[model samples]
Target: MDLELRHLKVVTAIAEAGSLTRAAIGLGLAQPALSAQLKRMERALGGELFVRGPRGVRPTELGELVLERARVLVPAVAELQEEARRFGRKRAAGQGQPARYRLGGTHGPLLGGLVDRLASACPGASVTTYTSWSTRELAGLLAEGRIDFVLTGVCGRSRPPSGGGGAALVWREVAVDPVFVMLPEGHVCAAREEVPLAELADACWTNVPGDGCFAQCFAAACARAGFTPEAVYETDTASCVHLVQVGRAVGLCRATFPPTPGLVTRALRGSPLMWRHVLGWHPDSPAARTAEAILAHTRAVHTRAAELSPSYARWRRGHRAAL
Candidate 1:
């Protein structure tokens, strides 16, 4: 069967918008033209592509399957166009430009440090950083060639994509940040050189709302300790340090918290206790090299940060002293 680019575009637009009229508006095409394109493509394939309803157009089982395949194929074609445009510019200039790398993560010190290391390592490379979003959204950006790599605190909820999602990206575990409970100097918890999860499970917590990454593990640890957190406030911003400083509430932060006034962080007691933040990328992207570079840089930064941080040094000294 023969097909055209318009056919794929129409299908993808409709799938994304879930309505032909909205799809037409999004694609800047007349509704009739868009409908005709879909109909012709369905006829050529000898089947109906979508079912129309009062609400909107819903993809049939076949349409849903075709749309999934088109999701991968369509973006790939667009990326090829973008790459070709860049390549043509390079050819015109007699010098290929350095590769661009896009990276983002949840708003936190760890991600901030990761971005710093990437910029330092890939000097002259294009870089973009974003904060506050889900990993799945990052995965979508990767598939579309909008971002090269993503480094975020691992939620431990990601399954290896199998059918549709699996085709789009791959995840690699880079480092697991030991869970450190941050407290103000002379706070009750600070009396202990090292605290146990069970010991602090009932502690009043300062949490970011809708944060499945750290929140999930925090909740699980509380459950394991037979108590839940007494969350006094919900926030999704980068104010954990400030909140802890004022003694508003205790919080858990990664190992990379830079020196701040009145803040002390210590690891929770347990073998292999920590939050694992992973790097993500589209496995088939042309920017995979750039992604790999960013990941390598991030790992080095994590190691170096842990080595240099006074909090980590104190932990090591305490552990050795106990031994």
Candidate 2:
């Protein structure tokens, strides 16, 4: 089509101003040029766009419909143009990958493995991993296209969209690692098959900032165990594994724990507690291929973690006597 945005701009201005003279003045175009552009557009669209009256030019019904579409089309085209320019600049830089990816999660044994696995698998792809304290920050990045994918716990149950007009991002469950109580080798609770909540009823538990979902779950579990927790020290970072390894605190729970060089995991007997991990990416993203590759890598790690649990069970036997 010989159609151009200049035609739409002229028509829209005329419809809004309700006069060709005012529209032409606003657009800095001669009255005849603006009128000619409108005629060209009407001819191309196979309909009359304007009706001239004694007072002014008014949009026809067809013109109203075209104007409505132009409202959306104009900004969408502008954004596409900006994106194309960015892509050109990135290409010129000779960036390592065809697409950029941002992935984030709080540090943990599971996430550590995931980062290594993803980077190794997509060696040519650029992957940025952020250890953030805010879920909203992560969500905002996804919405703004600052990040391609995010791996974290669903902070809590949230309400769905009211109108459901927009596309929902894709989310997949990654792992459900139980919140384990981490303690040093000879703690009394570690000797038991499962650490009883009552056993630590009065124990001073070290608390980390509840910025991530796992930390929130940990706080709730402690409350269910019937105690407002007392923290020996509070750090914005979840360095509980460090505190546990040195026996600074009696115990701490996390979604993923590094295999303590000397520390051990005491499963609390009952409903085996765990935090849900989710992988997410925008459905409309251009990074779909990168997101798919990252998701596949994470799933494989989760599967391998499942297969390796037998080793954990075997290791638990040696720690049983201490419990």
Q: Indicate which candidate wins on TM-score.
A: 1
User: What is candidate 1's lDDT per residue for 56-159, written digit by digit as tens?
Assistant: 98888889878888878877877784686466445635654355766757666667777676677667767788655455445555655566677776544444
**Best candidate according to lDDT:** 1
Q: CA shift at 16, candidate 2, in angstroms? A: 30
| Alpha-carbon runs more than 4 Å astray in model 1 | 1-97, 156-166, 209-214, 271-273, 316-323
Q: Write down the lDDT of every candidate, Cα atoms only.
A: 0.67, 0.62
lDDT (0-100) at residue 323 of candidate 2?
A: 22
Q: How many backbone clashes are present in model 1?
A: 0
Q: lDDT per residue, candidate 2, 1-323, as tens digits?
A: 58765456567778888998998766544577678767778889999998999999877899989899888876686576448546744663565446456776654455667877867876776767777655544554554455667776643342211111132667777755555666678787776656766567666666454333445555676678787666645554346656766777755554244455657766665523555667777665566546667777887876666445543454345455532
- Score every model by TM-score: 0.64, 0.59
